[model samples]
Target: MKLLVTLMGVAFITLATQSQSIYSLNYTMGFGVGETSDFIGSPSFRGVTFEGRGFLDDQFSLGGYFSWSTFYEKLAGEKFTDGTATLTGTQYRYINAFPMLFQAHYYFGTDEYEPRAYLGAGAGAYKMIQRVDLGVWSIEENHWHFGLSPEVGIFYPVGMDSQLNVNLKYHYVFGVENSLNYSWFGLSVGFAWGD
Candidate 1:
């Protein structure tokens, strides 16, 4: 019983020090490409993602994200049949992405409607599945790939732990044999807990 009480106190203290930070889940839909077009489709890529953000102080924040993005490509050199555009010569590329960033936000004023804007940069690695039309060409590129992440976001406080915000992020990778450029617009709804 005494041990349980001590654990409860520790939990309470932790909650007190960590400012109630905001967490969110967002959906990303966009298109992009890199070096080998033979292994992936046109520029139409589809992606879904979830990420979390936490406050380090009133103006500083830290966050991380992971997501899967994929698309299909056609190999035009293969057997041709308009009605039979099968998966025979097409490539399906699936990328698993992980990114972490430290952000600094500037709030316009001391009002509830005060607009907040932030900018930050980070790096990520991708696990890639590369397929080809004539045959299946696949490879997994590890951390040898590095990226630059820049984001601008805004927030409107509703009560405190809740808000509405919009953000734009540009992710450019240089470590891949070919640079993979990805850009996304995010619309988010979120809640803050703890602090």
Candidate 2:
């Protein structure tokens, strides 16, 4: 993660030295839906994301983002037989995830206030914690995995230095085991500012 951030910093400096540029900060709120959600038995996982990017030109930009999300669910109380012992109770399941990525974007537009669209892809790491709790016993696991995201979106200019940003991205994480794979689709809305 530190290496990815360092590489992005180098790219930003390299780009800034070459042309007139802009910088932006954005916040996004969204829901996580898919295999990871299914694994936790909940499809309403909530996420918060923060990102910063440096635009070297009208068509190219580079940045990094950090996001966190949690998926949770509760199961009704029940009794089960575990070998010779019988266990009874309600259970809770939760999964927390943190993702950090380095991204590059390509925009299709002609001017600062003109409407534009972009396509981008990012690669990095994801840290996840999965846990299950019963009245008397609990289990928890953590893992770090390689991940990738592909995104598409539109930017609606709102001012000389700002725009409303909306996007959808597909996220995939390679798991230790095939069944541990994490896949989800996310949608977000935010704003970007430049100077």
> What digit string (tens of lDDT, one per residue) describes model 2 on residues 1-195?
567656755765665455445444444443455667666656534777766666766688877766776777887776779899988788887777777777888999867688889999988877877788988789887877789999998888898778888888778888875336877766667787665
lDDT of 1 by residue, 42-149 (tens): 543455554555555666655554445555554554544667564435433544444332333444443434556666554454344433324555655444344556
Number of clashes in model 2?
0
Clashing residue pairs in candidate 1 (N, C-alpha, C atoms within 3 angstroms) = 19-195, 20-195, 41-73, 89-133
Quick one: best TM-score, which candidate?
A: 2
Tell how far residue 134 is off in model 1, in angstroms: 4.2
TM-score of 2: 0.78
Residue pairs clashing in model 2 are: none
